[model samples]
Target: MVAVRRGDVVVANLDPTIGVEIKKTRPVIVVSNDSINQLSQLVVVVPLTKNIAHLSPSHALIPKGVARLTFASKAVTEQIKAVDKRRLVKRLGILPPALLTQVERALKNTLAFP
Candidate 1:
């Protein structure tokens, strides 16, 4: 599990199976390259958002359109306020069959509805 101290800025992995967990941690006031070093094993570190871009230069820079759905899906899932499965589907744009199945399974096991 990725451990983050309180007040650390972090992002969540987009995969539902990976769940809402700290994906990166930026140093206070300044984004450090090391903020993303620990994420190498867990994610591709695509620079899909402004916060992402500030973290590191080595991260893969995904085009905005391609990453929009991914970022939204991850954000919606992390909210997990109620069982709003539609939000997940909508944010994904076009969910892959395998990814859909994995999300369903994770929801069943975690009962994460939001």
Candidate 2:
């Protein structure tokens, strides 16, 4: 597969090495900078979970039927992590540029920036 860009939703293998884990295969959004993604073997991603209750400002709800997901999912900003590009299995679809901007803003908030 080609390099994934920001806002692109893809199926990812999230098997953990140890400890409490949100492991296994799941849908994730590529949230890394495009330039870095082009050069690095790893990219940052946010896992998408079906749980959508009490979403914080940092969590963006991906509505049902969007992309390859049959049900609504929340992009759990707090659970963001970097994974090998190989972990990304298949490309589902790309979220809109506007929504990506909102995601970026949410990330900034989640990460605590001025």
lDDT of each prediction vs. the true structure?
0.28, 0.85
Instruction: Spell out the clash pairs found in candidate 2.
Output: none
Which lDDT tens digits does candidate 2 get at residues 39-58?
A: 99999998888989998988
Q: How close is candidate 1 to the true structure, as a TM-score?
A: 0.25
Measured by TM-score, the strongest candidate is 2
Cα lDDT tens digits for candidate 1, 61-114: 222343133332221122232111121111212233454344344434444444
Off by over 4 Å in 2: none
TM-scores for all candidates: the values are 0.25, 0.89
Following a full C-alpha superposition, what root-mean-square deviation does model 1 have from the true structure? 16.9
- Cα lDDT of candidate 2 equals 0.85
Clashes of 1: 3
Shift in Å, residue 89, candidate 1: 13
